[model samples]
Target: MDLAQVKKLMLRHDGCVALKANTWSESTFTALQPLPVEQRGAYCVLKTVELVYLLCSVHPLPI
Candidate 1:
């Protein structure tokens, strides 16, 4: 999928997801699914031998 499609899908998700981050990659994209309310605004941390990655969300937290 393209950025526009990803952005659109993320926008439709109901949760507090990250809209921006320091970097991005294909792995940064989470599986499209319903997130729990408590898990909203949560950031996914992926650790590898060479690098540690963070995955953000498209859903914005309430102001």
Candidate 2:
């Protein structure tokens, strides 16, 4: 996902556009660092991975 798409998904989670509360916090700072500088969209891509691991449910919710 692009940065815009990542931000859009984040809107569903507490309206958090960025990964962390403070600029210098760990996750926020990590997301700012691309896995590889030459890799295209690596920043957003990294965020996408984190979002999946952190937010995605492991089991189906009962309705």
Candidate 3:
């Protein structure tokens, strides 16, 4: 899958999910299945001893 495929799929889903609870746990995660390796997003849910979540998209960035 490519960004075009991802963006196409997002069009089916409402572009974003409602930010329910604003928290993540041992069970909650976002998994875009049946996708090719290229269309995947980056994740950094853990940083050493801390848990960090972002409301950001990674297809493009200043970095």
Candidate 4:
């Protein structure tokens, strides 16, 4: 998804704010390498992937 769509989805679910915080931390630290310049939305993408994995693991399928 594009950055705008990612932002909208995060805002809808309260994840946007946390993402902003993570971005800020990367900016403020000198030793910490900022997320790849190319992967501006990588964190959000990874988080969404993780959430999907968690849900699938915990939820049972209907027989």
- The candidate maximizing lDDT is 2
TM-scores for all candidates? 0.22, 0.30, 0.27, 0.30
Winner on lDDT (2 vs 3): 2
Show where candidate 2 strays beyond 4 Å. Answer: 1-25, 28-36, 58-63
Task: Encode model 4's per-residue lDDT on 1-63: one tens digit a residue.
Answer: 245544555567677333333433454343234667666466657655654443344341121
Residue pairs with backbone overlap in model 1? 16-41, 18-57
Candidate 4 has which clashing residue pairs, if any?
Answer: none
| Candidate 1, 1-63: lDDT as tens digits | 144544554567653344444334333444313556555345343222112111223442232
Candidate lDDT values, in order: 0.37, 0.52, 0.38, 0.47
- Per-residue CA lDDT of model 2 for 1-63, tens digit only, reads 255544556686666544435433456557567656675476667655765544444531121
Number of colliding residue pairs in each model: 2, 0, 0, 0
Ranking by lDDT: 2, 4, 3, 1
